[model samples]
Target chain A: MKPLLDLSVYLVLGPQDCPGQDPVDIATAAATSGASVIQLRDKRGTTREQVQLAQRLMTALEPLNVPLIVNDRIDVALAVNADGVHVGQEDMDASKVRELIGPDKLLGLSVSTQSELDAADLEACDYLGIGACFPTISKDDAAQVGMQNFRHLTEQATLPVVGIGGISLANAAQVISAGADGVAVISAICGAPDVSAATKELSSIVAARKDLG
Target chain B: MKPLLDLSVYLVLGPQDCPGQDPVDIATAAATSGASVIQLRDKRGTTREQVQLAQRLMTALEPLNVPLIVNDRIDVALAVNADGVHVGQEDMDASKVRELIGPDKLLGLSVSTQSELDAADLEACDYLGIGACFPTISKDDAAQVGMQNFRHLTEQATLPVVGIGGISLANAAQVISAGADGVAVISAICGAPDVSAATKELSSIVAARKDLG
Candidate 1:
């Protein structure tokens, strides 16, 4: 059985944030530095490219024992034997993804509102990507969940929570302190001048806040 | 109002197949050369990148009057205001996508068997992408529908049928003859040494066969 994931400093990489960079390399840098998990979030590229990238990332991450999660495309995740997949409200639901990926793989759901959270089959997901904690360019339509709502939502969530959207070292601790088990970032680590350093800082911050609890 | 998609000579572009080519350029070439509809099937890349590519394809295809259909990512389709989204069984269901994209946009569902076809809420789909009429390297998991199954399925399908998976200039006419209104191709167009020429040839073959009907 695959080990349960540590959601701390989860790195979400997309081509938009890491233009001209190999996704595997960017993920390797972050995973090696401190990111606990890596989620490949490509909304464009063929199944072949996605599978190839996932395979490369799996090769790189498996030795580190870091889990590679594919976002939105379960077929790509399965094709490359990735550790898991993450889906948003607009993507396939968690139950269906669970059935497809099976029980061994981690399944993540993106939740923004209390009603959505209430309706979610919590048993189907390993973690919840609770997002838009602040306005984010990562997702233009992501509704901001703000600190208060984020805290409330996390407090009630049975599944682990990884705060996403606009997360960075500067505010990651705040999100963790607000009750998220970790912070999921896109541009913060992906577009940073030094990805490893950025990941380390975010990891330390999330760790410190979690330690405080 | 977006013009009703011709659904003839539909081109499906994937980053893996295109290699170094820009999706917009390939889509433009295909559209101008006689492709009737363009489906951007990027199984990888961030939502931002997908939306940007869809926007570029929309810009390239709009004047030519070819509809741009996004594969799987409803958020990206909505973000760029593209013509529609195409989803497979493992992806989001057509009904949910229809609810999200609304009645104004096109919605396509991929069906490989009679049971899948029966389970499908046909009213929710604007068209059906039916196939694997032969073995297809494009989707490793696609079950070959063969000409007989393709003909039977298309005969019963109330929605327009676009045969996909392994469809090529050599076999496209056969699929059209089998009852598909069109053929959705990936490698046959995107990987060709000359995309426009390839698209033109396939379009002519499909048109000629379609004309016979």
Candidate 2:
């Protein structure tokens, strides 16, 4: 599958309380509002529960045609028939995943270093997700890849590149200008009081940049 | 959970035609003969097929108390109730996986460089699966870490370290002498004609190191 050229926002859902965040609700809201890719990333849930949630989210986002990516889960993704699966630097090897999923399905790899990029068969993958642009509570142990790494890697990648981790509207443009094809936001969209409004504003940033070419 | 200390002989499965050997049958034979860890490393299946194979392998190996480590699918590992999941530098973040799967599950991360080793949090993981101690075709892009990198990382890790990628009984002692808790093999025990005998010899090597203290 050819990767989308527009900036894709990955909505991160943290559980309720610790500052009033809701993952499913936020993702639903983001999808309805126009987030290109709505990925479910709740790392702490039973397989049954995670699959059910992914199914519901896949159904919820169907109308928008916004791809639902199950974070680090091939089973849940396959069970839910999600649009794709997002694996990290410590997840499954992308080439192996591509072989398992076939060439038509989208398989994304999280790369934090140049060696990983060199190691991957770019032809087999749809895109590369680079991240933690800023430290975020979503993944505390995310490596310090920094914005420069983002720019360099994205520029170097043969496939589309999505920037993840702690991304918000405030820095989305900078990440895009840094050469990322898309920006995957977690807390920024999920935590917004009005997800629809937040997505509209974020989407417009990517949409408005078409004239830059 | 504390890792099993006495367990030895890491066996990996490979494809039949490639690398002039078959990894799956080798791994199966090794498991039947009492190998400690049997890893399914087929990088050629789709997500659905991979999960199915993992499920089948888990069922096959469960009776022997042999831990089945999936090459890189935490979701598949969780799906199959696999003993654990092994990942490389291009996979998911190990700490994130620990959070997703909880502390009780086993999470092993692959390390090929001193930088990656130094960056990883020793406390978050159950063990370190280090490797490609020599050149081999089990993995197409196997990065030869040389003996020095192996020695350096294993010495620094507080957790049990398993050497992987092209490890054979011929030089299994080198990995152990370097402070590795175990050595992971791909085509070694898996492709041998007398699988049981191959594993027994490898196990003895891992065992003979008792005098190292």
Q: Which candidate achieves the best lDDT against the true structure?
A: 1
| DockQ, computed on Cα atoms, for candidate 1 | 0.05
Interface RMSD of 2: 10.6
Clashes of 1: 6
Instruction: Supply the global lDDT for candidate 1.
Output: 0.85
User: How many residue pairs clash per model?
Assistant: 6, 20
| Stretches > 4 Å off in candidate 2 | A1-213, B1-7, B14-25
lDDT of 2 by residue, A1-213 (tens): 634434456564534312554456677778877787876775655445676678778777777777777777776676666777778766666766665465556777888789988887777677888876777776877876898877888789988888887778888887778878778876677666778899989888866653463
Tens digits of per-residue lDDT, candidate 1, B1-213, equal 545968888999867668877878888888889999999887666554665678788888888989989887765676577898888887665766676677899989999999999999899998999988888898787999889989999999998999999987788889989998999999899888999899999988988998999
Of candidate 1 chain B, the 10-residue stretch with the lowest lDDT total is: B43-52
Candidate 2, which CAPRI tier? Answer: incorrect
Q: Please list the residue runs of candidate 1 whose C-alpha ends up more than 4 Å from where it truly belongs after superposition.
A: B1-213
Per candidate, native contacts kept equal 0.00, 0.08
Best by DockQ: 2
lDDT of 2 at B7: 35
lDDT of candidate 1 at residue B94, scale 0 to 100: 70
